[model samples]
Target: MAHAPAPKAATAAPVISRMLVHASEFRLNPSRRVVPAGVLIIQVKNIGQDDHDLAVRAANGHILKVTPTLHSGDLGTLRLKLKPGRYWLVCTIPGHEGHGMVRSFTVKKPVKKPARRR
Candidate 1:
């Protein structure tokens, strides 16, 4: 009997942005503030000794996705397929946002390629 072809493994999305939170600090630092419109993967590293999470929201305050709470030294990732626009990233850990744990990001429209002539 002939066997069927094996399935291929899924590929990981490109990590566009990276963030880190230090222990005892009420801040969330992102490596990039701008990204090209498409599948976005934000990798957050919890280098601090505290629990932290990430939230992505639209300009109108509509939440898109939230990652689970990451413990100290834990790595959490947030994946979003977004359009070109402005967005906000906040850490809703009680008073974390109030303590300046929020950041704004923008998704730029993809540039069109030029046409080629024969």
Candidate 2:
């Protein structure tokens, strides 16, 4: 009998940006930081042996949440847009927040366009 050809695997969308958050005693890697006001790509890698969540609260009281059940050597990514302001990012897992998995970051406004010359 003749054999059939193997199926090709689907390619994933390329990540424009990435942020690595390591799980530890109540804190994210690089606890405090700043990002530009635009599409922000965040990748959370759970270096610990437990599942973790990535959450963000905007200055306008909006919330974004992502939970990745990270087994050892696992990772997840979240793509989001942020405005200029101060925001809070945290992992709300039980006992995780208190342990220091919370962090604060600022988003700056995009530069304005230059005026046209006559």
Candidate 3:
């Protein structure tokens, strides 16, 4: 007689985090100031009349990721896996960050749910 096939192992669902960023002439606004550590998808929209781009920087003064230049009314997206720490979103264009085009946000560990009692 033939043996039955092996059962597949169970896996946990992945955690997702999302953020919306608005880029203007002299400012960058985020939808939220905090999120859980996991895969993060950031949607950047250029709401100003000038071309702009977004750069993700860590608290250690290192640039993590950057998006392509976006013209007025343009949109771009950036996907990253972030850990529990603080990050900054800024426009790398000349004189942009100095002109108030920067924002700081935080990420925390995901909260674990309590197990059900029988």
Candidate 4:
């Protein structure tokens, strides 16, 4: 009988990209203002006493993604696949956006590695 080959070992652990935001009565604070192009896991903590939500808009002023309304002191998460450009985060609740519950983030292009010489 032929011997079976051993399974290949993992070279490295897959990176878990994440972001944090604090949602209050009138503002959204993002931990990062810029990130590279890829999928990002966003976590939000509602620090205010009112219900709030998080929405992301494209550079052209169109909403791309949004999370459900979370109660006060609740934690929420949103996963977004970002491309190279700018994006805005806002709350869509009545009078929320008007009250300046908005923020911005930028996605930079991924750099290519140099080719190896023969």
**lDDT per model, in order?**
0.77, 0.70, 0.94, 0.88
| lDDT per residue as tens, model 1, 1-118 | 9899899899845435344433235777778788788888887877767788888889999989887997888877887888989998888789888888788988888666678877
| Residue lDDT tens for model 4, 3-107 | 899989877443346889999979999999988788888899999999999988998999887888999988989888888899999998989999999998988
Better of 1 and 3 by TM-score: 3
Better of 2 and 3 by TM-score: 3
1-118 in candidate 3: lDDT tens per residue?
A: 9999889898767778899999998999999999899899999999999999999999999989999999999999999999999999999999999999999999999999999899
Model 3 / residue 117 / CA error / Å: 1.7
RMSD for all candidates, in order, please.
5.4, 9.9, 1.5, 3.8
Off by over 4 Å in 2: 1-17, 60-62, 112-118
What TM-score does structure 4 among the candidates reach? 0.80
Using lDDT, rank the candidates from best to worst.
Answer: 3, 4, 1, 2
Report residue 72 deviation for candidate 2 (angstroms): 3.1
For residue 92, give model 3's deviation from the true position in Å: 0.5
TM-score of each: 0.77, 0.70, 0.92, 0.80
> How much is 108 displaced in model 1, in angstroms?
1.1
